[model samples]
Target: MPAVQKSGTVLIRAVEGAQGSSRGLEGEVRYVYYNEPVVTRVEPSSGALEGGTMLSLYGRGLEEGSNLTCRFGTGDAVAGRQETSTMATCVAPPRPVKDVVWLQVSLNGGADFSGSAVEYAYEAGATVDEVRPSAGDSGVDGQTVTVIGRHFGSGQGLSCLFGTRGRVRGMPMTSTAVVCVAPRGGPGAVGVSVSNNGVDEGQTRGGFVYSGDLKGKSAFVYYEGPERGGILVSLNGGADFSGSAVEYAYEAGATVDEVRPSAGDSGVDGQTVTVIGRHFGSGQGLSCLFGTRGRVRGMPMTSTAVVCVAPRGGPGAVGVSVSNNGVEGETASGIVSVRYEYRSGMSAKSVGRSEVRTGLGSGSVYSETL
Candidate 1:
């Protein structure tokens, strides 16, 4: 057999007998030789340290085989799948830290690899710098929250976690910004975190606040006398408020008239209670206060009715107050007359028997064995 330098069509002749034997028959066949694989470049030269980045490799003289493998830096080789004669893909392995590593390919499992190598960079884990509109309504869902940070690269399994409730899928708007919908939660401040690969996470402590408080900034101005000059206040650090305008109006405080079925079970939360009122402003800040215990946000169905959920409390009667501004000292008038009672669901009557009540203060009762 003769060794060929280039890959092309050639004629191969076979001799049946030993060397120089003229009595034997000769057979000729066409054959083609392939050169060693040469990698030209690799797509997505950078990825998260948690890995799971699909890398596309393009090259010449590449062949499809079962033993194909992709090796990243000094890590173990990962199995690769061939997409075409000149294109193959593989998933990158995880790295302990940020680094720039060389990527190599192997055609025969891990025994041998291609001579050419490409550079691949592993980025640092994402960091949370700020969350815009740092506060939101605790009773509202699907509120768009923008997350600003660094090292938020493009990848799968990207999500945002609000406190410890759970995670929601995040959409990457840029390398430093991600958008996520806020989920409903209780009133308080919570930590916010972001994950690019769903394994390693970067968090901001007390990064977001869930509140029933008013959503916008408020200020009180007192004037001694009327003047011709007008007062101008800079907003957003004197940033341009293009396509926006400011206006003022005189808003009257709300007044509570009556509360229906003013009672509920003490053991449950999210009991819908209706507060009949007037001058109830419709917007994001309306809320119902259960004395000084808890405050649940309210939604105004009309100027005469504001609906709210009752929070769980100990058995007793508490004053139900409605506030259109959601401010602490701005509860509506006639609040003392409106009341809600919380009754115990079960009470002991005898040594071995208990009384089970079905509704709020007044309902059907049944005897049960304890």
Candidate 2:
């Protein structure tokens, strides 16, 4: 069948034979080649892009004088739709929705092909959930952020879109979480997305919001040095730590690899603590928690030793940190006794994670007593 432009549309002509009229009244509209062009194939389909793109339509029975018309949705037909004898190259006009539609083509001979628009369909996945950290947390550029949403495992494009001029693509996704690296994004928060099929419009009702930066508070501190997996030290019960971690495969197994102050010595205001451990990828920095309001950091390090300031927080075995630089790793625990505190006497003792480091310092301070 053939398609043509007629009456502002693609028209198809069919031949009919009448026994009473001399085998089709010679010429006119009845005696022409008959058959409407059918949409046989669309190469490189799925017109789901914002920039300009081309489409190739292939069909059988294509003859001279064929015209193709394209439209998005059922709205006003697109103007200036073009076509060749065998194919049509029409630019897709703006659409009011994200959907599937048909491109109708008509042959002057006698055939018409009206096909619906193409859309991105994720065949095997669905929308999952989303995750956001507590009130006072921050993410850095190149740090992995997880978005717990479903239907992202199909290995499609996941773009963490900023406002208008900026975007980061390839956010790794699993069935539960879609992980993306921060791109030094501004305005503090942006939209969590599984591009082409994440949320409804541009809403983040169930998406991740990135907090401002917190790395400025980190002081370069003790590290056992480089390895494959990431090295780690713990501050809270189950937070990702730094140093000694090779690939950041560090888990909540904060046991054997612990940081400790030199034996028989008490942590003073300006003393450096000695650290010991495993899995420290590249120890970034550390800090201490004396009895203060917000956390702070002091001494920074590239190697083992981290200089720490006795936090102003009231006594107790205040927590010390082996601060990791957003790298993944298992955190180990250690202990340090705090002196000169508001809470009076009985030098506080802290075990495993949950120890608070008020400010920046290096080395491990909180551990268990044998």
Candidate 3:
């Protein structure tokens, strides 16, 4: 046996013994060249930090074999089943942080190959820790809201979403912050989320509240008696206090004072009850925070009144919250909301007490036949 260092075609002869002459077996052996991999492009040039993107690498001389290994970033990625001499596939690994890592490939224990020809960008997943002015009114359009979180890059791929309204490509203030104009939604609570590179980041720590305050900078026009209404006072340089109004009037937060029919039997699942609280803005923005069952349909009759059907649950104390046009944090500043208690059973006397049932689900009234 002898060493074959160079690539391309070459002649070779085999000998039987260690020191035997090279004429024992005389058959010409032509060596085939194994060229280095030349990568052409990487599909879906970018991916989320959470990984799981199926990446395709197209090039020539990819050199396919069981010993072939392809990696993305500094971490290991699972090699895909579809591999050939011209193309390869792999599942990207999770990237802990945003980066522009290159792809590396090794075949048959040979030297590793990597370069700019195969670059994959690792974008950190979008996260929303907080949404400033967490609440808004459904009537207000293009209401700017500040989103605070991580990996909010200032790129074309960055955008925000309010529930089902779809992505609103926002202006990125920083890698952890963004400013977006709130889209018009129904008078109810909606989830606030962000996305990067077309990948959804899930719901934020809290949701944006749509209230019925009808309070924005445009709402603050002072019509003086004749022509002296403080000269149309502009408290701030910009007369539009829509953003501030949302934060101050509702999003600043609110508290629940009491829930009518506070004490009920386990069978009170479908009963309509009125919730009394401060900052329960009048509008379709009202939603009931019913423990683990999540937000239930409710209506804000006024700043101090909300009507909702009792949520079915086991006998225990459950928290109740009301928001006026989706106020931020769904509570008033410095106010602690009251809780409702569920009892195991109520005597027939309690059930005999006649209480008018207001229709739940939609804020409408229908005749009760019973």
Candidate 4:
């Protein structure tokens, strides 16, 4: 049977005689009213290309039955459920390519679809690059966090996953930015992720930090070093080192005191060098530079010490410096007395061999197998 284009009553009568003969005998007349399904809108008109997005359709003349199905573009129709006279829902089928497809509803299974159609877009997977204001107080909630990345479609059902703890609704401010309220969490750093449909998620490892007692009278320190995680410090400045400490006492600017060995093989890249410093803030973005040769990231061992892998450089001495902000040439502290001499013939192939080494300014010979 053909689909009903308009809603109205239909009358049917069967004639027993030939046409134009005014009929000899007529059968009983039958009357029926037909109502065409109308779909007004579809919520979350966009989803990931993998599909499995439950779509809610709203309109009139939607009936409850077992034959309802939803069709996407030219693909096979999937089953749909009618919840009321004006609402119906169905799961979208997966598409191999990302594109815009027309969504239509069918009351009689896959036989036909509603006259009106809505556009649904299948997008590529989302990704996260950074989260701004990454650190916040654990005791507070509703901190606004801006997530930067790509492929975020505009619609409802967007959410943010704070570690494995829970999710909060996310609002898309742009294609590359999503804003969400940070939920209350325990003190520590946690991974953050964003999802369009709560199924496929994009994550950033160690993207956020929750601090403890940030506004208290006494100073509190929260640190996450490369080797160890989550170290907290509480100190006193009065007699016996017990009392409420002065504000910003421990927030002094970082200072570089010395670097051990102060020398390495110019051709070796993985040689570990230790830097002794003061007031190295406990967080991300710590780095070191070997003069103008190269800048390498440093791992904080404490407020007074940091470890870094020396970068490859030419033979000669270069001023070593540390940048608490992880930026090159933005040295937090450097001294002319502290220098690392990158010597020749100290390549990796020279290891496990006997050699005579001279101590700086000592003029003493030391026999060692390196």
> In lDDT terms, which candidate is top?
1
Indicate whether candidate 1 or candidate 2 has the larger lDDT: 1
TM-score of 3: 0.39
lDDT of each candidate versus the true structure: 0.66, 0.38, 0.61, 0.65
TM-score of 1: 0.37
- How many clashes (backbone atoms < 3 Å, residues ≥3 apart in a chain or on different chains) does model 2 have? 88
Candidate 4, TM-score vs. the true structure? 0.47
TM-score for each of the candidates: 0.37, 0.35, 0.39, 0.47
Q: List candidate 2 stretches off by more than 4 Å.
A: 1-111, 114-128, 132-140, 163-165, 171-173, 196-203, 207-370
TM-score, prediction 2: 0.35
User: 2 or 4, which is superior by TM-score?
Assistant: 4
Q: Is candidate 2 or 4 superior in lDDT?
A: 4
Q: Distance (Å) between predicted and true CA of 150, model 2?
A: 2.1
| lDDT score, candidate 1, position 291 | 82
* Worst window of 10 by summed lDDT in candidate 3: 223-232
> Could you tell me the lDDT of residue 199 within candidate 3?
51
Cα deviation at 30, candidate 3, in Å, is 20
Q: Give the CA lDDT, 0 to 100, for residue 26 in model 3.
A: 65
Looking at model 4, the pairs that clash are 67-109, 352-370
Residue-level lDDT of model 2, residues 1-370, one tens digit each, is 3544442333344456665553433444432443445555554344333413345666643343344454444453443233544565555554444455555554441133344333322132233234332011233344445555544543444455433314556456455555555455442333344443332222232322233343223222212223211112232543643434222121221111223442212333343333443222233324433323222353443343333444344334433344343322122121222222223443445445323343343334443332
